[model samples]
Target: MAYLTQPDYVKYICSCGQLKPITSLYFCRHCLKIRCGFCICHEVDSHYCANCLENMPSSEARLKKNRCTSCFDCPSCFHTLSIRATLVQPRQASTEASGDAKVENKQAKKMYYLSCFNCRWTSRDVGIPDQPVASGGWPERTNPFTTRMNQLLEYYKAIALQEKQEKLERERKKFAIRGKYITLTDKTGLTGAMARNIAGLPSTDGGSSSAIANFVASQASEEVEELPEDVYTKEVNLKQITSMAQRLASPEWQPAEVSRLHPLAKLLSVKRSQRCRACDHNLTKPEYNPGSIKFKIELLAYYHVPEVKIISHESMKPGEKAALLVKLTNPTGHEMTIKLLQPEDVPIVEEEEQKSIEKSLEKSLNLEKDSYSWRAICRPASYSALCRVREVTRDFTLAQRDDAAEYDDDARHDADDVIVWRKSNKLALRLEVETEASAASGAPARAALALQYSYRNTVPPAGNQPHQRNHTLYTTVLLDLGHVI
Candidate 1:
């Protein structure tokens, strides 16, 4: 069993030169390389409310400012607010009778109020009336600055349209030097807002000559409202005042006193998908449902790469050789031929297409040497962790992972020099490490191991390549030794 508090003793070198644990790394079958978060692209797949498990389209979410209409959060504690029902009894008057004719109804009507279980806060505490319906009947407060905000939004939209027009006109002249093509905008009588509408952009102030002509500037007052006289003499209570965080949570009013605090609308959560920047292939895509914990497509490094675990190791001393035991497991269904190589002896292979990417990056970087290129440069100086380690090479073959093999107790023993034991798809190897004579005492003796293994790529017929499958891949892992005694 793995402990949550344990340190990351083994780290893999990502193709983007980042050193990350297996949990955070992803494997791209198309590129046959390991990728990290820094070398991938993320895009929003869906928007949802975590509290209510409600999903909405991105366009609607944007229009609503990414807030859930039914779900609410506690203004005091920020916890999810639950609907609590209350009963009320009132007298009803007969429609055809005189003013004195009234009927008493003991039957009660149920109303719902938002309540926070964690903080004992309720909607009635802030003077909000109970809702008739539990889900959608809650009253929405109008923003005091709504009119001004709408005016500003339209003003900016008009300005953006004007700038887009100027940019297009400039680009047209720059490209029209061949004198072959003329745009419909120049031929038709459309102008200003109409032309912007034809280009799929917003109309400019509904054909107004200028936005400033319609915009009304706010007036400044010379007189100021003074605070109450009791404010200076009254004793301050910290509990009655809202904290900075509570004020910022509801920015519309930003009430300062606890009495003015109201229930906050719950912010919506979004599901995102990540893609490899190099190949434009999705690395991870989650299910659209908010309640699901699974993903539609997940390419984690742990599933593709072989896992290595330290079993035991002898104490190390300066200028002495020590024995190290490590167990390797083949996670893939296909048999893998694993070869261990020295850190510096491993070769990095790139396709002709990827090589061109390097030249393009170099051109963008002004041909600076030693400076890291974009996606083109994967293995960086961080891989030098292996260069500091000294170890011998070992080669072995692991069987394919079989579900029925786990039930068989009998183990297979190999006669190889490094093979210690074999059970199913796992192989335990006895590795020897030699410490430097001049190595400082009490310093950690690090060891680096590179694995060149056969991988059966299952990514079928992606883009133009239909037969690109089965390849040899290289990955480097680093281990930390306690210290030289």
Candidate 2:
């Protein structure tokens, strides 16, 4: 078991050469390889409001600027604001009726306003009026530069479209075969104007040209504003002044005083799915419903790969052997045959397989690069030279996992020179760790070992392929022993 406070003593090597704990790695069943977060592609599946748990379409979320219209966050503390209601008694108005004074009692009505439970801030603090109905009745403040910003956006979009059209026209003219006769209708059935109209691009003759001509660029000002003479001498009230976080919470206004701060709309959260970049198979896909915390598909390495835990180890000394006790557990339902080998003994076929996978991925993605750029950038440096794994030339079989066997205390003592004891699906192995003579004192004593295991494929074979249930897979793990003495 991995401990939260302690460092990772054992780390499995990912297919991308990244060393990660088994808990953090993912197994791609289709590719039959280990994958890490750095090598996966993440896609946003859906967006929803965390406060209200209301799911919204991607287009709608984009329209709302990825913020929930109904839910709001407190400007002072940036906490979720709750709607509070209070009864408001109506004031009685007396008028001269038939030269006599009359009094009438009015019924009380409930009014709702936003309040933050964390900071005890309310809409009334900012002089915002309460609404008769709850949800979405609060006023919205519009940016003063909204019109200018929209104009700038349109101008840039038109400029980009104009450039694209010019490039296309140039390429077409260069490749066109001159015809003796000019036909009214093109053979492709899509004229330039018709294509532009279909793409919602402005006509070449007017739309973009007019937008470019009408756009006015802003001029930089040289003048600087002078601060008030009492700015440094004035007694400052820290409570009344808004902090940087509070001001940034409502970025549209960025109010310097706490009284000018307004409640901010809650930002929308997205549910994302992680896919293996090489195989394009989903490793994890969460459910679409915002309220559900479960997943539709979760292919974690913990369920498929064999877990290795360091039980105990002796102190390391240069050019000396130390006793190491490790527990290996088969997480799969089927029994597995495991063989321990030196890290260098593992065949180079695995690297060839990775290259083939990368080729396939590049072909599918139409990418010029051999593989994802992150794989090359994020690979961890190897530390296998610090210590060496002693030769163990025996294979052992681990039984399938049984939940009922966990409660039983009777562990089988089918022990050997390497095997210490055995339980259901688990085996404790006593191994020898040999440190290098040249290893520096106080440096970490690291050893790398490879495991060749038999894995049963649960996924059904696709197409006319033979049903191969069991396949041999190899994985390398690094062990961190104590510093050399």
Candidate 3:
């Protein structure tokens, strides 16, 4: 079994100079380059409640402060509160008071209250009443400073609007230029207010625009409320008080005592989609359903790039070459021809080629012209030091992956000195690694390797040019050998 927490023995160098494991990288087919988390754009797709599996639109989510109405969290233990039902006996009138003998009838009413399964905390702990319905009939607390908060919000909004108008006027004055041709409005001497008056339309200026209310500035009072005498004289119980986290969870009241803590509305979770900044293609996108773990598009580097794992290596000494064994697995459906070379031996992508690739990405900035946050995508090339490997050693071929190949009996194989063993899509190799003579004892044993492999581009015939598939791609990886003995 793969260990959940293990140090990375093999790491690949990404196009943007990042060294990451195969699992943490993404492949952009449009740009034919590897991208990491730092080079991708994240966007929120939907908001949802994990426990209730209730989905909400973005607007509704914002209006509700990103909380689920029917679900709640335990204010004591912060666990999901489950609804418990109980039978409540109704009150009945006595026959002696009515002066008539009668058969009294009453039915038990079922009531629901929130309880935490972990902490054994119920609504009765905080003196909350049980509800007749199982969900969404609980009374909500009203904030004492709601009026002040609204006034502050309106004041800030109006200030922002005033600042925005002033900035627009400044920008207009700075960039203003005379047009070559005179407009009919300018030549006919018709101003905006004059035109509005002539057309019998209301002028969109001052109070005529909308009902702009004047915000009352809050006043500071000199007198302070006296604290309870028990706060200073009486012994305090920490168990009956709320912690900082519990208080901040409900910011409106921020109750300091346990009795004031109420069942908190569950915060909503979001499903986000990731896109490659350079190619403008989706790297990973989840399904719209909150319960689904599947993705609509997942271009993980592990699926596109070959995986290399260090098996074993002979103990290394200064100035001596050590024998290293590594296993390579082709995760693709097609057979791959891989050659080991020094990093410098890899082909350098020309400037013209890079420009052509960017041109092929063909992202139009026109669509984002009005977007305030939009900016041109700029992808930086990988910065790497050439590996010191001596020679090519030799090239080898790995067979295509076959699920049924695992069931078949061991097949006949040719004996090769370089290849240690051969399986369905995996091959093991014995290679040499050299350590520097002047290297100190317990120094790190490191080696950089470049792999030249034939890749088949699956860029379909979508926009332009015929689909030309065959291409040779190059990747550089760094290996961490055991420390020199």
Query: Model 1, residue 389: displacement in angstroms?
Result: 5.0
The model with the greater lDDT, 1 or 2, is 2
Better of 1 and 3 by lDDT: 1
State every prediction's TM-score relative to the real structure.
Answer: 0.82, 0.88, 0.83
lDDT of 2 by residue, 1-485 (tens): 44578888899998777889998999999878888887677789999999899999999999999999999989888899999999999999887899999988888999999999998999999999999989787898889989998999889988989998889778766766656223444456578788888999987757678899999999999998999999999999999999988877777788998889898999999999988876688999999999999999999999899999999999999999999999999988999999999887776644555565566556654433535575465444466557887878889899898888999898877647888889999999999988999989999888898999999998876799888788999999999887999
The list of candidate 3 runs beyond 4 A from truth reads 96-103, 162-177, 180-234, 347-390, 406-414
Output the worst ten-in-a-row residue range by lDDT, candidate 1. Answer: 383-392
lDDT of 1 at 4: 87
Of the pair 1 and 3, which is ahead by TM-score? 3
- Residue 474 shift from truth in candidate 3, angstroms: 2.0
Highest TM-score against the true fold, candidate: 2
lDDT of each: 0.79, 0.86, 0.78
Put down candidate 3 lDDT per residue, 304-356, tens digits, no spaces. 78888899987777888878888888887888989998776777655564353
Ranking by lDDT: 2, 1, 3
